[model samples]
Target: MSSTPDDSTAVIRKTALNAVHRKLGAKMVDFNGWDMPVEYPAGLIAEHLAVRSGVGIFDVSHMGDIRVSGRQALPAVQHITMNDASKLQLGQCQYSAMLYPQGTFVDDVIVHRFGENDFFFVINAGTREKDIAWVRENTRSFDCKVEHLSDDFTQIAIQGPRGVDVLQKLTDADLSKVKFYWFTRGTVCGLQDILIARTGYTAEDGFEIYVPTDTATSERVWNEVLAAGKEFGVLPCGLGARNTLRLEGKLALYGHEISDSITVWEAGLDRWLKMDKAEFIGRRSLERQQTDGVTRTLVGLEMIERGIGRDGYKVLDENGKQIGQVTSGSYAPFLKKNIDLAYVPLSHAKVDAVVGVEIRGNAVKAKVVPTPFYKRPKRS
Candidate 1:
């Protein structure tokens, strides 16, 4: 299925589970050029709540993966990425980004260390070609080899509060001992030696499994996980709920939160920007910006009036002057309030600072507030 007749005529690619999604009555839409399910018949809100309180599964096979291996892999990876890759140990992962020479984004990525000289990257689907090209071109000078492994695997994410219990039922490995941002291999659902990582985008305790891309294996893994989690209220989630979940966690989206036009400082990603690290791409530009100071920064907004401010909605100051625009916004199903993430002038980004979002040509009142609007209580 496609979002419109025009979309159907285009060369839209589908995941291995495209038919399964249609059979489940998903509302399919053209995301970039990929035919993806935006929401299920159960609706976005229901799927959102299921992940927050119970468990939800997502077909994330469309996301791309790359592998780098060689004795100089660390220097090769460090040259292209902003984080300090030397700190990564075996089977560890870190949230990092690949940037252009201008100190702006190529794409935010998750770097995983599989071995001493072997590293992997999970990059955004929309920027797959660009990211791959950037990495290959820039790191070619280093004594390392880069391989495009995107087509070899399909990734499945099981997220939410009850996600752990559901996943442990299928694997013999002791998932409870796996630390956050760590990974291990095990036979799951009779699939031999697949990678299971304690990582997710939903800001919940969860695991993402890496399985072969064959439709039969992928569907079997999907169905078995659903059946195993049926008692825990696990639902099949689509991109709509996926967006809301990541937004609620203040997770950076490549196009929305970070982009070629947006600098790392403006996106509030200082924690991952290591200036003391060995010289890397965009380091000099970021260092100069740090001295000059940032003009605008990202902030969380709570809509005070009775309307939902959507992405690209104009954010106005108290005097009805346009300041910034909403990068992401929604009536958060789990939070039960309208919330947004936006970039405004430093002067207006303070906590409790009043601002207005132009909703339907009218400036609706909103206020700046703390982020991660919802955080699950830590396990006992």
Candidate 2:
């Protein structure tokens, strides 16, 4: 249930709540060199349904947190990311990505504008070190300090329709005023300086709380949240459910949907890329890709047959020629259908376009469908 690093061998690192996950009987797996929980005793399907209907808490402490501060912080951030950091007001967050010079993704990130001279970046877990180096390497000419603060913080995401109600019980901050893509700092569960943000990967009304990594504080908050959420039927969810939830929402995974080889245009993330910006890494390449147009584009696919398409699966056209590949796929529990996200040539990316997914060497029928296979109803 628990693993420890040895003096003579390499071992995966564990989060602050690794012991707590084991105590809850979670099925643990090695995820990118981190011991993470894949599912709990309730099983992946049940956990997925719990988050869709009620509330579910996820231990997302594995995510990386980087801080950039100084007078030139904004400029440094603007130079590295594709989004316009200048448009962000204090306490606001924006979904963005950093790109390589070739126009491919370094990683998708969330930029939190904490102050005029300070910014917080939340990046993918697997690319934490690489992202930090990239940020620091690019900030050499600017008067900014890049700090890797991932080890100093523990993060938890409480998601679902009833998430706000459950978290409101423990925090004094006004949950109603926290709009989407915004964050506020306040006391939570008697602890001060907790950053609660109204953002989530599940495409639901939820909050992600960032707290210091003190063992006592982390365990206390985790336990208190679960206890308070009892009335709302909160489940301790795992990565398996998290993946399914995000996939249904059409959220991209690092290696699957977007990668070092996938450009912003091909990934359908052009909205996040600001081409008008005077300068930024990958701007030239992205501009050229935009003007010339990308040969392939990511699209949503719904399987017409019983089989489920998976990553690395080949996508075929009507003439049985391979057109693309499925990047992410799963049997969506909430929708009760098999769906996938794939990259296909421009000719085959149109909605309702017929295609075939090579499943176990057999071409299965599928159709291009609208993305975000599932969307949460807008809260009135």
Candidate 3:
């Protein structure tokens, strides 16, 4: 398939489960070439509250799933990603990024080490083809293999306080033993060959279940999960709530936070990079930049006034000098306050510093705040 022009306005295509979403009365919207549900009757705020208070299920099949396996897979993957994939143990997952030759980010992904010399990568849907091409091109000289498995499987994300409780009723797998950022394959809800991972975008406890793309199985499991989650008030959430929930957690979005123009360190995702690892794409540039310090960085901002912050809003100082721009912003339903993520000059990113967000022609007062506006209460 050919890539569509960036400015094309044709109606976005639907994922395989669009029928299920429409049957549930989801409010659909165009999201990066996919006609995805934004919210349901409960609305975005209600869905947000549900995830924070209880649990919610999301249809995340739109995300690309790529498979990499072969004898030389470890070394080939290590060369493309900034993280040290060669050191990953089986059953562990590391959030990492694929970089361009020039050291700019191509996509931020979670690489799951499922076996020796084998891994699975969950990449942003928008960058699916680009990521595949980049990996294939780099690995062509090596003996490893790479395949795009996005269409071969479906992903269901169950997130919130009661997520584990709801999921445990179906799977005999020891849910308690699964640590954060870890996963294991087991039977789930009587379904075989399930890949359950304790990772999610929401600032809550959850799991992303990977199941084969089958009609009867998908339908049965979907119905079973909804029924099992009855006690938790787990709403069928959509992309609207998902984005808000992730932003509140200060999780970086691909186009908004870590784009081709932003380096991992400058995007505040330096922790995911492994600088000490032997040569990888962008390592030298990142290492030099880290030693020299990044000029601009992504930061969290809180509105001190009534107006809600939205993406692309210009940031300014008291004197009306433009400083930065909002990358991700919204009226946080949980806090009932406007919150945003923006990139500002390193000097202006100090915590508690007062800044101005230009909404329209007026400069609204705002202050830099610590990230993850919502943190899930630690479960014992």
Candidate 4:
């Protein structure tokens, strides 16, 4: 970690959209090394409900953006990732995990295929610098170039039912054709030649726009997005609402749900791992774990009793035996109940299985439930 100039207190970096967030009266907090907005006057619960019902915008500029461009782009990425990059066509994006040589997770990343020789990766904020360093070390053998572009670009996610509607008003691109996990170069808010990806943390219709760092352009795009989204009920959301929204969607958090000590198979992400694609870091260990059967698994839990199960809370059996621990939890505004994701033995992860969470030294009843506590209605 880098030290601050004062050396007495921690210094948090502010984003290009920090002014906008503060102007909206957002509750700011130290997230990792960044000063981020956690919530707004609308509150976490209200913002969660609004996204489930309407639309919202989030400043995710803190997330790291890296560009990998060279003749060996595909093979270079495939060598480091667990997913098969050969099948990825231009404009397609795939979620993947980077593993150590031993197969333990380093970080889960999203790769966007811009062209045959160019690609983009969006990595977790907490692991930004570490992830870049890992990529550079691993790609040393491959004939590829990886550049950390986090400082050059900023990201904004417009999520929910009306995301496209508001984006279309600002951009000339035909958004309907940009399917899920795909991207295109287009003009947004009069900024020509920018990349837009149809992706988001919230499990809803949305788009994540990458804006280059330029004072005039960033300011104009940020303000125009909010202005155009007025009729769509677009709310400027913070990390608090962002967390709740992702929790309801069952999206994995890097440090919480997954970390350098865990493997993807144990995290319920085997479907995203492509073992048949030759080989990748940690393949042998993960393959061994798969054959031996994983001991612990990540699953969703619903509180059958009162109290919200928070991170670090222990899960116990009916007989008061410690079974597992909650990784992330909250009072889901859409479900109107407490929901959480926990790591427990596979034997106790069945749906409807009884469990108890230790909250404030008291045992609260809970039950194993299907993940993705809420899903948006499919548009016809």
Query: What are the models' TM-scores?
Result: 0.96, 0.97, 0.95, 0.96
lDDT of 4 by residue, 178-271 (tens): 9988988888988888888999998888899999766556767888998998998888888988898888888899888898877787888888
lDDT of 1 by residue, 1-380 (tens): 22221232357777878888999999999897888999999999999999998999999887889899998898999999999888998989999999988899999999999988899999887887788888899988888989877767779999988888999999988998888889988999999899999899997889999999888988899999999999998999999999999999999998998999999999999899888899999998998999999999999999999999999999999889999989999989888899999999998999999999999999999999998787877885
TM-score comparison, 1 vs 3, better candidate: 1
lDDT for residue 353 in candidate 2, whole number 0-100:
94
**Candidate 4 RMSD computed on C-alpha atoms after optimal superposition onto the true structure:** 2.5
Estimate the lDDT of model 1: 0.90
Name the runs in model 2 displaced over 4 angstroms. 1-9
| CA lDDT scores, all candidates in order | 0.90, 0.91, 0.85, 0.85
- Candidate with best lDDT: 2
> Which ten contiguous residues of candidate 4 have the minimum total lDDT?
1-10
Q: Find the 10 residues in a row with the least total lDDT in model 2.
A: 1-10
lDDT of 3 at 143: 82
Candidate 4: list runs displaced more than 4 Å.
Answer: 1-10
Check candidate 1 and list the clashing pairs: none
The TM-score measured for candidate 2 stands at 0.97
